[model samples]
Target: MAVSSYMTDAIKIDVWSDIACPWCYIGKRNLETGLAEVAGDADAPRVEVTYHSYELSPDTPVDFEGDQTEYLVQHKGISREQALEMAARVTDVARDAGLDYHFDNLKHTNTVKAHELVHFAKEKGLQGSMKERLLSAHFVEGRHVGRIDDLVELAVEIGLDADEAREALISEKYVEAVRADEEQARAYGINGVPFFVIDGKYGISGAQPPAAFSQIARQVWAEHQGEPAAV
Candidate 1:
């Protein structure tokens, strides 16, 4: 990760992720676990988690057919066997994080629009729930985040105004914020989801165990006191 500017006080965590990515979902849970352990109250650390956009399959076709096996082999240059193996590996990882991943039913639609929806969610002060909903829609409920009507339906189910959500999706509003997030990821040399930057100075990458994130959160807290590093 590129060096983010400095900070002396509360941590500012900006997570770059794609809702379609299973690891991103687990990463969110793991990071939250860590954050909870490190804080005094349940919401301790008083985190302000801003979700940034990173499309895993930006050029993915608007509509795709068949199992993910064929999709991966054809689009990602991986063989069917390799793709299945990869899915199994990711499934195991998600399971370790206490999630049930059903890749078989997963409809891998282009997530650029979903990312756009998240940006709009941010403006609506519903980014957190919207992110959670989007992830569940894709990973658990098998909703098609790539389709405007489906996405609008899910957005409304999550308490967002349905009409507004549909309008924004169709009008492509708040796309610049999504693009800015992607650009920031590129500028920071981020190539994967679940990348976390805490306190603007302390950096962490990948969906590490919650203990790791808790340790870093405490460490950042210690830095504020100029005390020895917290274990």
Candidate 2:
């Protein structure tokens, strides 16, 4: 007997987020909650979420010699006190979303390598799992996401071929894909994330409440059904 896969009539949700961004993780959690809510509703539409790249601080060095608070103060031109305050607020928000954000130990670095890993995973249909693992590694485990070796380990942990993933990154195979996402984000005028694009038309920004996502998803799925199929 041939093995079959489970599938659904899914609404495409493209999300652009950075692993280093606390809100990105929270947004991911919120989106997952929303998708789960929709999936449970018999009349609601299913969602197929995809992760995309958006570097918050591309110029950051792979070996940034500071904690998150210091980096924010230097890059954003804020006082040390303010940086700590901002981090505290986001930490509280993340905690509410069932995330334990170790801001004090966050290893800040350029997320380009991490983003490239995401694209690699995308080609293998493992983007969602890879995305979550990278985010957790960066925000919770205080891992280095900017280096190729570190990323290779993470990719392997998720059952991806280690050699293939390493070669992909070293050769920059998906660099263009990451750039394409940035270009599309520019076209969309998205300056911040985690930004969500539904069916390539509807745009939702920020870590919105789960209820909000469910409501819009239902509305869009209903509207989508009314339209005739493409020629």
In TM-score terms, which candidate is top?
A: 2
User: What ranges in model 1 sit over 4 Å off?
Assistant: 1-9, 40-44
lDDT of 2 by residue, 1-231 (tens): 121122235788999999888899999999888878878876668678888899999999998999988899989999999999999999899888898888777888989888999999999999988999998988888888889999999999999999999999999989899999999999999999999999888899999988878877887776656643222
Candidate 2 has which clashing residue pairs, if any? none
Best prediction by lDDT? 2
Tens-place lDDT digits, model 1, residues 60-177: 7778787778877987798888999998998898888788888888888888889889888888899999999888888877778899998898888878998999899889887888
Residue 203 displacement in candidate 1 (angstroms): 2.8
lDDT of 2 at 40: 80
Angstrom error of the Cα, residue 104, model 1: value is 0.6
Relative to the true structure, candidate 2 has a C-alpha RMSD (angstroms) of 5.0
Give the worst 10-residue stretch by lDDT in candidate 1: 1-10
